[model samples]
Target: MEVAEVQKQYIRELLIKGRKIEAIKYLRTNFDLTLRDAKRLAELIDEDIADDEYIKRPGPFSGGGVAILTIVFGLVGVIMLGVAIHLYTSNRSFVREAEQTVAIVVSNPSQPVFEYEINGQTYTYYSNVESDPPSYSMGEEVPIYVNPSNPNDVLINTFMDRWFLISLLGGMGVIFLGVSMLVFFAARAR
Candidate 1:
């Protein structure tokens, strides 16, 4: 290969790997190229790589659609779980009322953990299945229902936030249908 071409490749690779000193040394040794030229070449190569990679990735519209779908479906699961909890609480009375000033119960069906404390009492709780907290504090006030007939039998917290999960489920459904429609329409077009 030509001397200039060899120098350019070496400079480009070094800059991509962020080796400015080595690139400059080689540039000075092999080619009479200026420091500015070396820097410019490196920058151009890096930008070219960046631009190419960006083009290969999904665009904002389709990518954003997928993102929206993911969030929507996630929320759907959550909302459904909340609705189920609410129904169960209302029907079976899972929430507890304490004659004592402080009553502790698992945060609700919403949380996954070993225990949560309210007032003075500590309530032992867990998910229907074994799991750990999501690592972020996202739990809000969970509505709990208490049995009027019996005070001690409290643990009935209704999962009133069914809509949260519905959004997720609905989002997933929409995305799926959208993809399916796209495929169907494309097939017909062909």
Candidate 2:
């Protein structure tokens, strides 16, 4: 559950300044907290704090919670990066070992299709290649690398074809990593 607000600090400050009515008013106006809730909060604050010093207490979303969220984001980023790396390596390896041929491009609703020939046999593969306005035009010849054992497995040997997914995932991973590091450091500092 998400907290509506953090009024504890403000309430504590008001209590420290000996303005109980203002503290209660602030809680009611800002957080929509009931009188009982405001009084309860005031009492809790009074019990925990002394006259000279304010003891810092952990709330629902303490530093620990922030740390946990950081870990979760970091893990997701690592998983995405790992999958991207695996796909990139596998595609590169397939291109290096598979038979090279030229495929005729055909227009499709979702994406362009590739029609290629292998040992007098024609095979059609839906391209996963992403581009605005489509990269290959109808009747265009594109370089194709297909697995010898399983002809269905194909790869288009282009920078966008080979590196788009990897780049996207790697970029996301970097962003998550950066955010997690920043959150972790900030939480620690706090």
Candidate 3:
């Protein structure tokens, strides 16, 4: 098939940007050419633009530094994912052995203080987490998880309280790994 003028221009641009593989794939898809033919045409376009003074082509190592940085970020993401998995498993076991109870917010300074009754005795608990708008208000009732053996060991039963950290770390890990893969592919194009 005879390549259109516009297609030729686009292929040349792709080659100049060090996307020869993409240019070849484009030809195979749009022009319905065989893989070998598409590769040959893309190489021809690359050679045609090799000496064009106005069009600057990327060096062989153009995105090498960015690829290396992304790899480091990906490694950090893997570590975060590992930590998240560990926290999730540990929290799951704790939840399974925990007992549920209703607690009232007694104070709301920086962290909310909760009061609950167990076995006809009153126990007071303080939230370790602090939020800007505050998760609880004074006089609000909330459900909590507690170790039956040790009433002092307690946790808020809300989903956010139980899984927020794990979710955040897992999300960040996936994003970093995805970005690393994209960067690595772009660098290889050079």
Candidate 4:
């Protein structure tokens, strides 16, 4: 496809701004060119404007900086995965020994407090997880698992209450790890 004058100007601007990848992507999408052709066109545009004093060229350590950042993200992903695993195992152990009972919501919506009876004694404890638009209304009855020896130790008998944090951390870890891998491979290919 023939490049329009406006497209060429935009490509030149992208190159001047050190956004070669974006320029290549624009050429691929707008011009219906193969990756190799788009990349070649972008590089040609970059060379055409190499002498322009306004261009902010990348420094020698730019690639190294990206590699270092990718490594840091990978490390964070590993740490998050580790914490998720620990929480999952700990929650599993707690649920194994906990007794089930129905508890009434006694406190405000944002910070729900549960009240339950064991034998002739009553116990009220704040839920560990709090939600906006409140998960439970006041006086609402919810099934919960409570430690027999310590009534204050409670877990709401719902997948979200017990597993939300684990799922969130694990999902973020996977995403970070996936992105890091893709960047690493792409850099290596270049």
Candidate 5:
């Protein structure tokens, strides 16, 4: 909204009284100006009036949108972490009874694809199914654990294969929680 001449004069008076930050906050509340625009306008007012009243101040970080986003991100991270933990435990249990064999890395265009033989039957597998990084070179031999009941079910024998999802989701959770804490504390500081 366009500020009336009287309102503009009042804003200038506020700036002259060393209330430039308050003037900007007032502009943000009363006008349609963004925070950046309000700050810039407040600074311009000080420059034009030859006053040193304008002092940059940090704005509020707390908002409903930020709170909602923090909750959503934190919840998703927790859910992913939970799934990873569950799969890791299940894989561990299976590995205790599963058969171990060597699988040869056959090809990798986007993800690694490998094959192994069990009882004269060749089984093809994609590394993307495990979400493990494609660290294997072509023809490289890697150990894998295959479920005894279902030969098709397998797990790569590596620390990353076991804990990758857990680490990823935990890291994301920490980051989201950290952001939320920063916003929460910064708002409270004011």
Candidate 6:
């Protein structure tokens, strides 16, 4: 016979009442619990723990290696972000002192396309709509955005490089598949 949850609770209560020996006997007779199980359960209740959930073990490709690589990239990205921030902060004075040059919106033909020259490099930014450039002139000055530390760090156009992200995921998937194949072959060999 299988022991019910309520019966288990009743046994637990008896064990907590300092009648552990009696509880074990009752559990063995009524619930048909083994002496070891009754004793272990009683101990758990005495310690105020509800239950234990067993965790299933992971095989080699729980795909944790891909996650590890992603973590490495994230760490590198954080370092890059820090470097950019520092450059911006340190070059603030230089940027303020440098002459701001205006580049006309050649594409929009009507909007102001501002260009800033810093560190012998030309940095450009569009006004208001940085994501989308409105039609306008070759010499029109809209607005120029620049990095305070390094002017070379810039956005040349509004286009997004989605291929980079796709390539990264594809690379990780290929690596995982390769590693899994290796593990499979190695296991077969053994």
Listed in order, each prediction's TM-score against the native is 0.26, 0.62, 0.64, 0.64, 0.51, 0.29
Instruction: List residue ranges in candidate 2 displaced over 4 A.
Output: 1-54, 57-64, 107-110, 128-132
Better TM-score candidate (1, 2): 2
Writing each residue's lDDT as its tens digit, candidate 4 over 1-190 gives: 6888998999888878878899999999998899999999888878778565446555433658878878988988888898899999999999899998999999886789889987668999787776887888989998988899998888888778888889999999988888878888887665
- Candidate models: Cα lDDT each: 0.49, 0.78, 0.83, 0.85, 0.77, 0.53
Superposition error at 53 for model 2 (Å): 8.5
- Model 2 — which ten-residue stretch has the worst lDDT? 1-10
- Ranked candidates (lDDT, high to low): 4, 3, 2, 5, 6, 1
User: Model 6, 1-190: lDDT tens per residue?
Assistant: 4667897777767755556788778867776689998777667655763334223344443557744555555555555545545544545544454444444464443344456666666555544433335344466443333545556443322222213333454455556555555555554453
Each candidate: RMSD to true structure? 15.7, 11.6, 8.0, 9.8, 11.9, 14.0
lDDT of 2 by residue, 44-141 (tens): 77677686765445643464777688998888888888888898788878877899999988776237888999988999998765567777678988
What's the lDDT of the predicted structure labeled candidate 5? 0.77
The better-scoring model by TM-score among 2 and 3 is 3
- By TM-score, the better pick of 4 and 5 is 4
Looking at model 6, residue 33 earns an lDDT score of 80
Deviation of model 4 at 33, angstroms: 25
C-alpha lDDT of residue 70 in model 5 = 59
Q: Which candidate model has the greater lDDT, 1 or 5? A: 5
lDDT of 3 by residue, 1-190 (tens): 7888998999888887767789999999998999999999888877787565335555534547775687698898898888889989988888799888899999974588999987777899988888778877888889988888898888888877888999999889888888877777777764
Cα lDDT of model 1 by residue, 1-190, tens digit: 1347666776666766656678777766676678887566556655665533322334433556645654565455556556555654554323333332222333433354334444434554443432254321334333333334444344423332323344554455556555655554554453
TM-score of 4: 0.64
- Model 5: weakest 10-residue lDDT segment is 54-63
- Model 3, CA-based lDDT: 0.83
